[model samples]
Target: MGVMNELIDPPGIGTLTRILTESAPMVEWKQTAATASLLGDLNLRARTDLVADALVADISTGPVPGYTTASASFRAALAAPKFTGWVLWPVSEAAVTLALASDAAEDFNDCLALLAELTPRLTGEFAVRRLLARDMDRALAAILTWTAHPDEHVRRLASEGTRPYLPWAVRVPALVRRPEATLPILTALYRDPSEYVRRSVANHLNDLARHAPDAVVDTARHWLAAADRNTGWVVRHGLRTLIKKGHPGALALFGFPPASVAVSGPRLDQEILTVPGELTFAFEISNTGTRDVRLAVDYLIHYRKANGSQSAKVFKISTLTLAPGESRSISKRHAFRQMTTRVHHPGLHALELQINGAAHGRTEFVLEMA
Candidate 1:
């Protein structure tokens, strides 16, 4: 079975339906159960949609008066021990959908309250997007408040909800256009005590870096001025993409000086290989400058795609300090394994060495199917 099916299978949905009935006698369990029974034939997204639609229909038809009342009962139902972990994800999705529907008509305060209460159990990050689209300032206000909330999950929501490129969630164009709006929220949680919150803060800043590198670099400089270990971790993670790109500011932040190195002796173990095989290579790095320098060593493989085009993937090798006239030998083995996400085609592949973002020492190998 696929991952989504495993997460919310038939048995789990049945249990969730039963819990709803027990928590709110006013709900028409018969209809909800019937809807859930048909979910087995649907894909993961479809199943989520069907379950949510059924619940909304049942709540609208049953004795529950309005969106707020129905949301309250659903939140209470989810409190049962059985609805823990990923199983509650679908329920949260459904509840958030309902809240968004109500929020569209200007009945949002109750929905926001429901999300704050429900997010600790399951994320309301997806639902919060509707608010952002309808009214950005209002959403920003709510998100800023969440950054200070006692619950780590809610504080995380503040960052996760505002991410310009949040996976599986709709993009916020305003934030994409003006990423600075997020600076307030990020600054508020810069030194958040919870690792969970700090990680989300890093991811949010990373998204911003893609659009506004200078802004992110400036923020990194400010955050690094008096950073604790945890806050420093966030800055490092936030600067990963910039570091990979060899941005001078990002490299300087990590103490990697200008590139003053020599690369030589590039060798590939095999000139030809097959799928499910390994490609090993080695090279040497020598410091050619007058002073010691920190080197961030990385390599890139220009993979030939099935379309006869090439794409590059960067891999980190190691980081070390090299004094003048010092040299070090480094080696790496890359396995060309078949993966569900990628299809391999017979073609020529090239590898290159990178030191602090400067490229050198190129070599090539051929790949074929067995």
Candidate 2:
């Protein structure tokens, strides 16, 4: 994410300004003023908005509506050969911002079409989110048709743009609340020939599992009923979140039915995990059930939160099948590295094993700040 922010750095904006100047006759976009205040760690969204704000401000200066003026300016900018890549992110954003200002169905629909055009250059996923928020039903109606569109990028946008929990994109409350809103789109593209499109569809379905597990499972089941060579892969990816959370239906979908098992120690190399150190742990599980049982094995880490509370996070370990009386040893080495996403605090912690949607043994350990 940090590296992506650098893609639209100061020099990149200069290039954007140069392209705008050379591309469109009416686009006299001077990004000089916009670049001045963009000092420091102005995250990716901030950089995109800064540039879009400049475009909207410049193009809408005349009597024309911002949407009308900006849309035309951006459409003209597209004629340039180099008018692609990360620069289009702001352009797509600016187009949507202005189009929504008109509040006319014509402009809103045009904005959707514009995003379809721009998606091939760089994803208009970030920009189209606001449109979905504004008029979900109307936008989704248009997006549904995109699932069958010949262009792979447009098909991908149909699924990717409507994800309920699309990361780095603004939340659409209606979509999150009514998770079924985008199922038709997902259903259509689940078996898409393009891996890119299929990936987005799986992720879109996975997002649904976060809030609407039953619906997600049902959808996966429906897809599985009409199975293809790629259906299993798509369903597996779609159920990833549910699988990680040890959801029974998800585990069952992959034929990992619950079974009786005897678990041994999750013994650690050291009882105390020092900062900038490694923790190696191993455990063994035996299939005590009479029939062979498939397992989805995972490990859980209960880390001490900053406020002295503990939060359990699950990590994927491995998956296997064991016959009755069969046993297997699971071992892993976890590094306690300082990361931007998680801040580690020193205190009591624990490790546990999760097999077949059930947690087995837990071993306590201490975290020390070195």
Best by the TM-score measure: 2
Q: After superposition, how far is residue 89 of candidate 1 from its true place, in Å?
A: 4.5
What is candidate 2's lDDT per residue for 176-287, written digit by digit as tens? 8999999999999999999999999899988999899989998999999998999999999999989888888888888887879998888899998789899999988899
Candidate 1 C-alpha RMSD relative to the actual structure: 3.9
Candidate 1 Cα errors over 4 Å, as ranges: 1-30, 62-68, 71-106, 164-180, 207-214, 241-247, 265-284, 327-343, 363-370
What lDDT score goes with residue 42 in model 1? 70
Per-residue alpha-carbon lDDT of model 1 for 1-370, expressed as tens digits? 4775656667877887888888888777565677656866677667766666777777778775457657767767766877554545556655656666673454465566667777887787876776787678877887788877999999998899889998878777898999899998998898999988899899999999998998998999998886877877899899889888777788888888677888885799999999999999989999999999999888888889989998988888889998999999998999998898767778898998878877888888899888
Give the distance in Å from residue 244's predicted Cα in candidate 2 to where it truly belongs. Answer: 3.0
| RMSD of every prediction | 3.9, 3.9
Model 2: ten consecutive residues of lowest lDDT: 24-33
